[model samples]
Target: MSDTSKPWNSPMPEPQFDLMRRILSAPSPVGLEGAMTYGVLKPHFESFAPAEWKLQQFMGHAGVVLDTHPGRDDLFKVMIIGHADKIRMQVRSIGDDGKIWINTDAFLPNVLIGHEVTLFSEDPGAQGSYRRIDGGTVEALGAIHFSDPAQRSGEKGIKKEQIYLDLQIHGENKKQQVENLGVRPGDSIIFNRPIRHGFSPDTFYGAYLDNGLGCFVTAEVARLIAEAGGTEQVRVLFTIASYEEIGRFGSRVMAGEMRPDAIIAVDVNHDYVAAPGIGDRRMQPLEMGKGFTMSVGAIASEQLNRIIETTARVQDIPMQRDIVGPDTGTDGMAGVLAAVDCVATSIGFPIRNMHTISETGYTKDVLAAIHAITHTVQALDALPDPHREFRDNHPRLDQAGALEHQGSEKPETADK
Candidate 1:
């Protein structure tokens, strides 16, 4: 029984929340994520990183790595990754009616209707320049009177091909009018809804909580580790990746390049406790305001998980166990995909309505993830020998010894 009447306030400090807001506000749609990574995260990283710390920039995408100790193979390396990209729509074609047909990438069509969006169009006249259009609204058949009976009753779902953006162009020569404004095919469109406080305390709901929250957690953890005088025995690579929404290509590339001994991928998880229509899947009841989640299955390293769990317990930080089977469905698989030969696990906070215009999260859970990861890194640094501990401490089946009978000591007759 929690207080429902309580007003919501941000759990993070003003500056931290401002940083998070900026990160979330910066559009980092799939193929074009540099705006967020290079524009926001790079500056944030540089502001607090020590003089000896190295900031590694990528040659292609906006993926970046902040290394506490560069070129130190002797030290145990740990890479903490969080992708910066958000799922977005791309311009497919322009209709003569002035409707911009779009390819809805990773979004359900029903969520796009009537919501305002920002179209980032590349300047045709200037090779690298771009223009931003902020007044467009995504639409389908427009009014309810135009919808078919099946569509009105929700029996038929909206298709991605049917989705288009309306920029309020009228009269004739609509296509020419759009082109004149530099709007063209292949432009990226993102939800213009900014993140803000929810009705509940310490809650927030808006666009792009999936991975922007992940990057925010990673960046905050990096700041914490830096302020703690840095690690002595471990070289930490704090990475903000790109293209995770597409296929985790950027994080896989980072893993291949760094080849760390272990990786902790921070990302968002579904708040299955509050998520609707997921009861048939029988997922664990993970929810917001429950601290952070740590991966328990999949390619998640058991030994590495032990370190994080122990850190959480020792630090008295609230945590939830997330069971991810076969694949983590996150950048946690970057090491495996790149054949990096490293232990890997995922850390996250549960957020409801993922991959939608109004994804929601709890700031307390985010702060918990930051603390958990920071302490885990410090715990690794304090270890006598990290490589040997992880290599030699794998769970053994023989360690359980023999099982004893719970009922009778001797065998009983078949029919007795």
Candidate 2:
């Protein structure tokens, strides 16, 4: 093996330790239930023209109450205010049995009565529940129903097909109560709770960490750049793409929209921590506690390689390079093809057992990525025109080729 101990072997210094410390301290773990909840609630929160009255009404009937805990009072308040501003409510009804019904007609259109649904609550105080409905889309004839918790335990883990919503309302005749409330079949059922966080002194986990980490890192970079009085010639689009896992939909749309001169896609690379298929040559050789990996391959741009290498040299940042054969299978591929003159690269962290409920990464890797990306942006701003340099440096390639051709003609005859 070649000596990997050059000056470049030194770990790059990252300044975002504090921010990453806080991030790792915060909880967000991804799972099937969380993903489903995100699909239901994401639209409500991300919509520009939010449905306010509808949301307030739903909260009113769902008996959504807000309470603050000691250390996280402000966090809870912000979350409440934010959720309230997004979801619109169509129906809020109370049942004789004291069950509550809250409906948002426009949020989900394909909902059917008796379809099993899982309910996630936004408030930490609310106990997340799962339920089933008796009738749906029948207009005044439908009743929201609840599943027995005992029965749920016996069944294999929550099945999406078997779940249904019990909009808590009871009537002697279900039709009469539904009619009074104006509930419809196609109305979306919002998962009640924000994805919760599980935190320890050493680990933080929650939903939406796939690209959420990217979002967090980019935002911090932007803040740092602004604070450092960097010039804003390069328009840095800190994109929080949606639907990436499904089909790279958000990145596809974003690449077209930005059409940037260059793109550096930051995504997680597999970390082989627990299991053993991954090897240093195949995936990232990066260790959990080591640092970030700067990949080189068909997807990486020559321009980007030059900048990153130069930056690493000047900054004394530790970086490792690996060959990504044909395609990186990252958003970088999309962005590179979209622009007239585009170069793409990826900075990755070692994430173990990706696409599972409990994907893991090191705090150190996250910090290293932040450092690498920030320096990369700075390097891009300072880089001289590479095309011009290439033309000047290699002016006589054609002449050299012809001379080599002439020399080759005399070499073939030699029996002597």
Candidate 3:
């Protein structure tokens, strides 16, 4: 889109997924969850990531902030924002009477009680509830209370009180700004943290990388396709899902919304470098620099697996196969259940100490995951309708259907 010489035909050197694996696998320090999240979210949020160049063609504009890191100064700062008016009903502590109290003075750490703290909520109906209070006074009898000991005891405890912000603009001038920009009170607020490329160029860390890396990969694929003049009949939806760590809620919602012909749920998998329970025997042993792992189990359809496997073989991409046994416990579950004709697959990086601050992955796995996913998508796009039909009628399906049709089928068979 920028008139740069497109390397659509020229064989671009396959990224060394091994390098990504090594970098991500490095022992991260404590309190670096933000680094992980930032790693994942940065590509989606900034134009500096390689994928931004391609996304510009499809989205018309890259949905990324250009000036992500402004100052060279370093200071450890953390800002927490309440979600909409839910802060209004903020519950600080359990009261002696077993009731929750509202603490009007319970302002966020650095901001003052009456200060305008940015509030963000995903709910559309609750976005406009911001209101400023005089020194942030809470109703003494209200369900929220402050943590200050002086305010507690008589009727309510300051520790039991919580403060809520009313973000609604009351003045006419403020109303005009809202009308022009479409900013409203339940509108979700996002705080921007300067993207800090660590002091060492070889090492960097920040927030939001959990599934952000997957989002980045998708963006890069989109860019590659756009630069190749785009594909015919296939549309890719690069989604930045919410609530993945909490409960795969974003994937569920995305699956329900798109009901795509097929789905590939990309996320991180554990790399047992330092951990004991995981090894090469039971769980597919993944090295930090090996590449991406593809899951094999009931959750992944044979057809999709074959397609992915074949593509990787042809492209000479390094990949590992993981057997998940009965279930994968991934967003792939939600994707499979969303539509009758859809198939779901998993592509994951090797992360160590998952769900912890020290969670690590190799840079190689990241690059490998990107290659694996792009190849899978291309393979799927190239398949004809008849191929899909044949897969549905394959012997494996017939045998399974026959077992179901015949009441003589056994419930379970133990491994010999």
Q: Candidate 3 residues 36-128, lDDT tens each?
A: 223433443343333322221112211222111122113111000000011112323333332223333212322223333332222344553
Clashes of each: 0, 32, 65
Predicted structure with the largest TM-score when compared to the true one: 1
Candidate 2 per-residue lDDT, tens place, 1-416, comes to: 13243322333234444433333222222112223223323332233212221211111111111111212211101110001111222235434443335453323322333333333223223334323233332122232244455434645333323333455555576555644454443333332222222252223343223554554455455455545564233444444343344344445555555454556666767654444754553554555555666668876766566777777655655556656788765566656545434556776666654433345665556655666677777655554643343234433546764333445455553431
Runs of candidate 3 with Cα error greater than 4 angstroms are: 1-208, 277-281, 386-416
lDDT of 3 at 104: 30
Instruction: State in Å the error of residue 393, model 1.
Output: 1.0
Best by lDDT: 1
What TM-score would candidate 2 get against the native?
Answer: 0.50
lDDT of 2: 0.44
Task: Report the C-alpha lDDT of model 1 over 350-375, residue by residue, as the tens digit.
Answer: 99998888899998889889888998
Give the C-alpha lDDT of model 3: 0.44
Of 1 and 2, the candidate ranking higher by lDDT: 1
How much is the lDDT of residue 163 in candidate 1?
98
